[model samples]
Target: MERMEHTSNADLRAAADTVLARLVGDVSGTARLREDQWRAIEALVADRRRALVVQRTGWGKSAVYFVATSLLRAQGSGPTVIVSPLLALMRNQVEAAARAGIHARTINSSNTEEWEDVQDEIAAGAVDVLLVSPERLNNPDFRDQVLPRLAAATGLLVVDEAHCISDWGHDFRPDYRRLRTMLADLPPGVPVLATTATANARVTADVAEQLGTGGSSDALVLRGPLDRDSLSLGVLRLSDAAHRMAWLAEHLDELPGSGIIYTLTVAAAEEVTAFLRQRGHTVASYTGKTENADRQQAEEDLLANKVKALVATSALGMGFDKPDLGFVVHLGSPSSPIAYYQQVGRAGRGVEHAEVLLLPGKEDEAIWEYFASLAFPSEELVRRTLDILAHAEKPLSLPALEPLVELRRSRLESMLKVLDVDGAVKRVKGGWIATGQPWTYDAERYAWVARQRKAEQRAMREYASTTDCRMEFLQRQLDDEAAKPCGRCDNCAGPRFTADMSEEALDAARVDLGRAGVDVEPRRMWPTGLPAIGVDLKGRLPAGEQAAPGRALGRLSDIGWGNRLRPMLAAQAPDGPVPDDVAKAVVGVLADWAKGPGGWAGGVQDPQPRPVGVVIVASRTRPQLIHSLGARIAEVGRLPLLGAVEYTGEVYPGPRSNSAQRLKALDGALTVPPALASALAEAQGPVLLVDDYTETGWTLAVAARMLRRSGAQGVLPLVLAVQG
Candidate 1:
């Protein structure tokens, strides 16, 4: 450590205590920093050294930075710049700094209107700290214009959630990798600090190595036990989704003060939220789909204990601070123990004890596979993207590039960011441009990452089934040297919760799960730059030719019907007649659709007219399934069976393709045969357009337009499953 003889150790300790008291708002004057916290702060403030503190949540990681900022500012240093990952964390840190009479400002996507003013304040030395998201670090204007100036002047640099910088970490983000550029630009003697509640030995080593970049000395590493004394962990293995839902509805009220209930998917989150609310609990759903304003309100409500709980997906994880959060229950297991540890750490932070439970389901693996497919694209795709950017006359926006590549928009953007960090591509004013740098595709490294992911999945499985202490198992996974049986968990102390639930709750859960039918809204507008791909589609879809809002039996991401639909819809599944149970469920969906709000018989502003006939879309993979379903619906609804729309082109590309490519492959794929045209021309009202599945919704849209142009008055789409 770099030592300074100008100040005595005793005097430095006294100053640190005074700052802690102000930061914590401790009027009692008894607040003092722990020995390790003091060591970390002293290294940054007095020794001017980089440090990585791997401590558990609520271990006062923020306090170390804030106290150091206070001491540094007193010596006439520039403001501390925190590269935080989440908005919630930044807000909490800003509030905590205010208690110490420190002026803090934030620049993020939500406050773009105020960036100019915040920048002015920083220039005038009016702010003590400035928080920015990791994404902001690589934004073209910020990186090329504002970043160098800020780095040259920064007093102290803090990387919150530093694990994200490591490729091995559970939450690795490409944007965090851009920090290396700023790190290299920092003026001499600018101390740096990286902090996280999660990160195993490998991740720790990786982050520490990065911290040493552009510096002459290595970072001082301080790691502690990854155990929470207030957490009583356990696992409850149930038969199926119904049992799990029943258990939650019965025991939600029994969980200590208000807390969070996590789901694996947005659909599942919404489903759980609705089920709990129906069970007389005041709960709201929080997911990536939630509006920004609503997300803020939900956070505030949870902070003030206004709601019973928030049923959420992984989007609610990281940087969400609730000192007294009572419990955290996962409806399904996360793929990694490191990730689960970070999430459960949110609880038991400020309380004497809190409940932690995992209700693992058989379907969790399917969800894991779905997410795994979205990992880094193959080498071929990456090379194609680079080649396109290299030869382009000018910068190409994401939309303009979409038609040229087969990857989804979000995945494409993420790949570009990683390329930018590696110096192969540059994001400019209009879009992205190639830098002509020689880049090698590291096949070995990518393969190792894939293997590591599988290993984590296996570890999570072992975590759920192990008979040993749950806390010890998790600690060991994190490579904590202090791993040991906590003696406070359910396995160590015997069960504190019963597997048995009230029969009434089970029956209610069944009824709710048995309810079918979800809205499959029609795609109204064409994807941008479609004309560039040789297809003429552009702008809003003609209203008269579009299909009416549609309905489906369930989402493949749901806990109820999803369980039944997944296996039947698998690509490897046999193409046989529809199963008896699924046929009944389809009938149930139609029945519910007719009577529910917006249905043919329900009260609404503009109810859809009852269907006149049924038309089936030919499916190469599930021809029998589609034919049987369409015939059954026609028989039950007492409507004639309109002829099918024949497939007259190359084999379908399936659901894995992106919007532009899917539309291109489907442009001249299907045709309306003469018999189908005649039947549609004779139909009196809207037709029930049936398909086995809908992923991108392009197939249905195109087919609906064909039927409408041929002669059907209106079309209402029905599908077995809606892929997210």
Candidate 2:
């Protein structure tokens, strides 16, 4: 360390003072920490206990973890271990730490020898912080070789994205289950500092439980609001893949500096990138299959301004932070809103106003449903796993244990990790050993109950399918209320959404549907034979001429039951009664109400039939119709249901995903009987029918089919907040 002259110390002190004051500031501006951040810092200062932070993207989360490392250095030399899921993120934080004058090191495959050398500093207690991936932290060699060293060198255990410990965390990296073991191996008194950008109340509780964060978790665990005003929220009624691609092409020049386009599939990433490049845009593609060296180069070019945009997936998360990013576009529906926020957060890092465009594809929701399907754990499977854990004398190897567990090879692998999080077993060596404990029904059962997660899946689908303000959902996720509409998004700017579409549009015209959480008006009521529009199935979005036989509807059929709500031409009506295959799947739901999709004839006193919330993109409604719907809702309904209704008749040029208008419409149309509202608050049922217009009927068909889950009984009852 260089000795400082009086002048140098004073200058350094002045800079330090600015940081110190900002550390505890009340309202954090863009690129700055808010009172929530300062509160977290203050809590860390107070007897430093375990802290789990659930914040939204762009809330200056990195600054919180970085400041903690700063504190360690200020108190004199002490090592800090940060277990990150993303290699890029780990690398970035390591570089950031170095820049901040903190000695930071990382153990990753990028530099094997250099990684080995880090052990020396750690062993000598000279390294101030060590960034690692859990895959490394969980390795026997690393645990054996470096953990003892960690005990001597570190002052705190900093687990970034602590929410990963919970299955519900935005991006679940199954390996996160072993965090407790990582914590156990650390020095005895090192407090756990857990932080994440996406985690709700249940997630926070789950984090505390998994990390063994007790009061000894000491009070450092904090939750920050997931709010950002710099982002303009937009949603639109997109026609087809060609239109989406065209829109993307049109918006290329709108992006400044670096931008990332998120795709639901690997193929989509390549296609979008190639299309953009052909259109004369400086674009690159990054995905799991991308070579590591190539990916790094792509990242460098993006940051160095050699490339204007990159087409990627969640693969871009963790360590890739180019503070000057212009925007993040989703070429298809994201798996979850949390994922959407994380992906979009990559943009506006410098707190610059940014656009988050989500161009939904027909198959987007189905793609995720297939992946998220693995979320549910079976009782038979659970028992088989417990048996294996009970029998294993040593850590079981995958090859060795595969025969004993009756599950897909992949399922068993993931389940064992989830079991580990429940503390049902411990993974050791190539196998896992029993924890020598009796398991309670709730603990073992709820741990794998995937039905409780169905609504979350709905929320994700809603984000993509609903023509409402995308930002409001993001803010609400963080417990922040959206008071007004954000003007910059597609829904707000879309043309058809103007006040003159119809009488209901006039009533609901005051609110921006994008910001409304309610579902928009149904497209089914259009007079017979609306002109049929066509799209190229092979074509991408926002491109190609608009014409064909309700072609977009064919694509919509691919997204599951949610697709039925998509905008369609008045000329195109179902040639026959909509299919009942999906309805048969949930016949109990259709039997309850006589009204066209959402009539509640079942009374509140009746056992909660699976509840379904219908979000309708409605046109104008007479006051009499609104009162009629309210009166019907007040009657005990077979299914406890709520409708998010909107009245914006014609869609604008933007994605009509804004729900503000619909929410208002629903509020005006549906007044809960005080008793019905209370009953809904306490209602327990599966998410039975989440649907709107069903011409092809595939979207609703699929949703009705998925309502049989055991945990599906817990979907939160939907409520209409306002009228359009």
Candidate 3:
């Protein structure tokens, strides 16, 4: 039962081969090692006892473990261990290593019967190397079933997607933090090697820190040439959704061979796949929803050239390797430019001049905003969770946490997982143990926090409607480089680059409406009758001056100010006050009738006479108003500042009460003329028709041309306010 040992690298490799022969008899596999990979392999074998390999995704990272284990087995060192994110990946690595004539096995949740066998093999040093998902390693059964048995077990912990260890890294996993705990429980001197597809220098350094391995710079950092001369990358923004699909259709026929059309949703993937197939393109749909058998079939079909393209969700790329893929067509705006670039990277894997076309349209932002709003946890749920975790005596299981909290199962799980990563909870053998719970919120404080959480949700919603470059906007807020536009993003592709609020941009020849770069003759938001150094919205009537500096915005609260434009602040009059003449007439009649009570004719002084104008500037809103309103000057009796009033409060006059419902029956002399839309229609150049919301964009489309913008113009309407 004694294990043999060898001091020399050659002897170790020879012994490793003999050990592998015991399991996978003396087979040899291809060793097409890149120069850098070969160098890392040498460093792995030449080392005294332990080695680490940190490499990119496709650089054959799994090879380091397989090849090194071969050399180590020859040295008479026991089994090597690898832990990673996916079950399929572990299985693939283990199978490939076996085919290479090295004994390898995988233990994970997916395989029930073989799991015990694999663990048993690792225990007896029957397997040269063992592969398992991180979950399997974290199992307490690991210590009981296997760890104590291998006398020469050289534990080689390989973490795939290694960037997850750092909070600042692109991908962070709560389970990753617990990895340090797992490592500590292992025998000392075990080398942990972590690898990922994409990570920056900061993330790279953190990987080493998280692993607690002061392993030598012999700690490998190998990035094969980014000089993917075969890949031709290009960013594109389309004319519209229809046009974008047209481009896809044209390209499918025009391209060379296998392709990937990555859509933003499962619905999109299915729809596109069906549409393309109907058009005789031989397409296949592959998404997370697709069954396992179907997914593998789709992948195989694409690889065999039976399918021209695989229409898949974001889930598809990381799961499989389709090397000969010819092009990658992006179907929508990605959450970040980084994601866009990474998804596009799937193409041109095996050939020269592989094309990646980005398809972006205006509606993509709505999709993105919807996606962004999905991040917040319900406030009530988070509050209850903090309370539950705070008082916990032991690790809380999903079943226990569910009944103790008042939230949907999925959201609570995610928040608890996040709390775990934040060091608030530690995962134990059974469930989770709280570490530093902050659950002492009073009722009022919880209410206040809830309000703030809701506000933050609104802020994130508003962020999507921002007129800034989408990439630069996200980068600035998230990465602290807000204005640093990724030239590859749609905003950078906009006709105008400087979309910020600079005095220069205010007077620039062209201003980016950001998403909408329409060719508006030039106009600023202005109330009527204001010329004080203000420029009238260009392409409008001669006197259309810009909005005044001191002018305030108002909203319509009540139907008192009949046919009058509402501003943000209180109106000069609230109740409908009668004009002097109308008041005099009513008073005179009442006085005559009251001269003799009998002459009153049961009228009793005309019931306090209604105000002359029921002009209601609707103002009933939560909290106090922000500013005051003043005399709104009018152009042809049209108040351009009227749109600003819509911001004061949400208008739900009634679901059935359309904009013009029962207007003629109102007892008012002023007719609500539709002159404003007409005036906007006549404006030349590019004109930005301001509105708070653009649900159907009927308002924008109706007012489109008068804004002097065409469907084909270099500009489009810029809508601001809360996202729709």
On lDDT, the leading prediction is: 1
Q: Which portions of model 1 miss their true places by more than 4 Å?
A: 1-6, 213-218, 596-598, 601-604
Residue 451, model 1: lDDT of: 89
Candidate 2 TM-score, C-alpha based: 0.61
Q: lDDT (0-100) at residue 600 of candidate 3?
A: 24
Query: Candidate 2: where are CA atoms >4 Å away?
Result: 1-38, 109-112, 182-189, 212-218, 385-396, 403-410, 421-425, 430-449, 464-469, 481-724
* Candidate 2 total steric clashes: 101
Q: Give model 1's TM-score versus the native structure.
A: 0.97
How many collisions per candidate?
Answer: 0, 101, 48
Query: In model 3, which runs have C-alpha deviations exceeding 4 angstroms?
Result: 1-32, 48-57, 135-154, 213-220, 223-225, 373-383, 390-408, 421-423, 426-724
Each prediction's TM-score versus the true structure: 0.97, 0.61, 0.55
Q: Write the per-residue lDDT of candidate 3 for residues 129-187, one digit (tens) a residue.
A: 77666555435565445544432365456666676666544345555665665566656
Worst 10 residues of 1 by lDDT: 1-10
